[model samples]
Target: MNAPALKSKCLPTYLVIDTSSSMKSHESLLNDTVDHVFDVVGNSPRVAEFAHVSIITFNTDAHVVLELSDIETVENLPTITCQGTTNYGKMFQLVKQRIDADISGLTHDGRRAVLRPAVFILTDGEPMDKDWATQFNALTDASWRRRPHIISYGFGTANATVLGKIATKAAYLATDVDKEKEAIVSMLTSLLNTLVASASAQEFRIPDDVPGYTRVPIEFVD
Candidate 1:
């Protein structure tokens, strides 16, 4: 009789980006940074093995740019186009849906032990939808077993209060408006560093502080 294959733990990581009109000016840089992050993860065998990445972009509506995939096997990364309004409600709903589907797919055959998903949200503007919080609350409900650990990055006209509410783990807001480009770079860099560290530690880890941004205090309801 043959021995059973050992199961490895996998992290379902989502990169949620706001592709609203406000981000149009920095679209090229945004796409490049996203590609770079993927390249770096693909280069690292351990990180590639542990972190299954997915890309979700939202503007007037939300779309899944890439399904949860093993970094090493992905041949081409999709580019993000900046347009439309920033609909936070749609984004949150899509994320919740994706988390449910992705988790089920990952654990279907018992081949991999799926860890709690982590979502990295990068946005440059405020939510256009007033009822966005309803969707957000549903996505982050503590009673839900697969609720993701969300880390949000804000820049340009991004709202700190909104970021604080959106993030379950950590939130960061740019301190200087004049240095928006730098802030974007720093946010993506911190994400890459967090992934590498988490993979090595075999657990999810977030930076205590991010450069060009200040950590926002997340409020909890008792």
Candidate 2:
């Protein structure tokens, strides 16, 4: 019998989380949610066969907590540290550069090119950076062809205006940040499902309603 051939096409998924001081109170919650997400994806044969996952955390500065790797290879998801002010520009720039480098690496390694990447961002506060929009726009430039589909999520205290600009396809806001425990759980569960589905998908689709979130439609600047 022949060994199974590896899947040719791959999907890259980025999870960008906020680690500003405001999020300190929810450290445990964030940790557990991320743990569950990684566990679910790592164990799913479908996701493991088609997806590469990465984790990024940002506050005053942005850094990659986990570099892009096959989901199956993810052992420990880093715990985010809460400090400094939120700077959206710093995060966008980091992602843009990393994605460019990552895609190049994948192609060089003789792997089929990745489809448009998917980015899931979670933040609970407003951005403090001036001119953050410029960086965000550059990152989502449609001309790039490989531009990612960004799905932004805001906790209760998050600024809807900023998130609307950050998200490419959808922006979801929680009713009450940490107080609504059930809602938060539901939202995280829905996010996990979305991430897993995107691994084998070529297009993006948003759920009508994510148990604990309300869709906030955004108008992209031309």
Candidate 3:
């Protein structure tokens, strides 16, 4: 008789970046930091084995820069171009669609057991679409079993109130406008650290603190 296969635990992690025109100034830095992050994870055998990563970018439209995959398998990292307006509705809709497809694919044939996904969003400005919240609500519907835990990072002119509303797990805002480079580095570093720790702990782990940023309080209505 053949032995039964053991399912490996998987974490679907998404990095959702805002590539609006305002972020053009930091485009090169953003691309470099993202590529560095991938390189670090790809080299770490344990983290790479546990966390499957995807990259999503949003501007006038949302794009899947990288599909969820083993970090080591990604050959070429795409260059992120900053243009167009920040459309939150499009971003949220695309994230929801990708999550549905990703979760299903991960669990196919019971080869892997997926945990709740984690979404890390970095934005430099307020959303241009007025009805973005509607799309957000649909993506984060309480009834939906696959809804991800969202963590938002805001810098430049990003609205704190909006970041608070968008984050299901936590929100952060950069403290110094003069140190934009440092802030970006800190955010990406924290993300990499979170994945490394989570893989070691065998579960999802949020960073306790992020330098150059302040945690935003999330508002809840009864």
Candidate 4:
């Protein structure tokens, strides 16, 4: 008897990067890190088979540099450049809208299952927008499904309080590494590996802890 082919499930992953003026000095390093991370994920059978990756860049505004595409089909990933002030509010709003649209597309396009997406926010500075908190709160409201587990990575002048609030699962401070750029790259690589392994095993949630990454404490808001 011929066995039926199992339906392929899709796990959407978003990389939200800060391209504000503060990151200008390390822009090249950031590009290299992104390239390497994508290479590792794109080459992995587990990730390539199930992961749909997207890229979003935020500064004065937030925009999707790359829409959701399967790892195997994605090529020529874009490079980020430092620009205007960081507007976390704009970023959060765009992310919320994108998630809604992406999920709908996945459901309609024949994916057997579309797991809760994972969002990785990497930044080196604080938000210049006053309404960032409000936006973040709305984006992560309890009513949302699985809420796209957010993992924040902050360094350089980034505020811990902001990162913690934005992270739904855990926020990490990428310090302690010998070199700042190297540490950032290493942290990103680790994230990619963890994401691929978990999604391959059909686990979509981000872990609360990762080796060598310092956890940031979340702050309570009234």
Which lDDT values do the candidates have, in the order given? 0.90, 0.78, 0.91, 0.80
List candidate 2 segments past 4 Å from native.
1-6, 176-184, 200-203
How many clashes does each candidate structure show, in the order listed? 0, 0, 0, 0
What TM-score does candidate 3 get on C-alpha atoms? 0.95
Winner on TM-score (2 vs 3) = 3
lDDT of 1 by residue, 96-151 (tens): 99999999988874645788999999998899989998999999898999999999
Where is model 2 poorest over a 10-residue stretch in terms of lDDT? 176-185
Candidate number with the higher lDDT (2 or 4): 4
- TM-score, every prediction: 0.95, 0.89, 0.95, 0.90
For residues 1-222, write the lDDT of model 2, one tens digit per residue. 985454467777788888888878777887887788778878897867677878899999999999988878777777777888899998999999889988887776666557778888988779888888888888999888768888888875787777787887788888744474554466667777776666557444456677667788776632
Query: Residue 126, candidate 2: how far off, in angstroms?
Result: 1.0
| Candidate 1 runs further than 4 Å off | 1-4
TM-score of candidate 1 against the unseen true structure = 0.95
lDDT of 1 at 112: 55
Model 3 CA lDDT for position 214: 88
Q: Which has the greatest lDDT?
A: 3
What does candidate 4 score on TM? 0.90
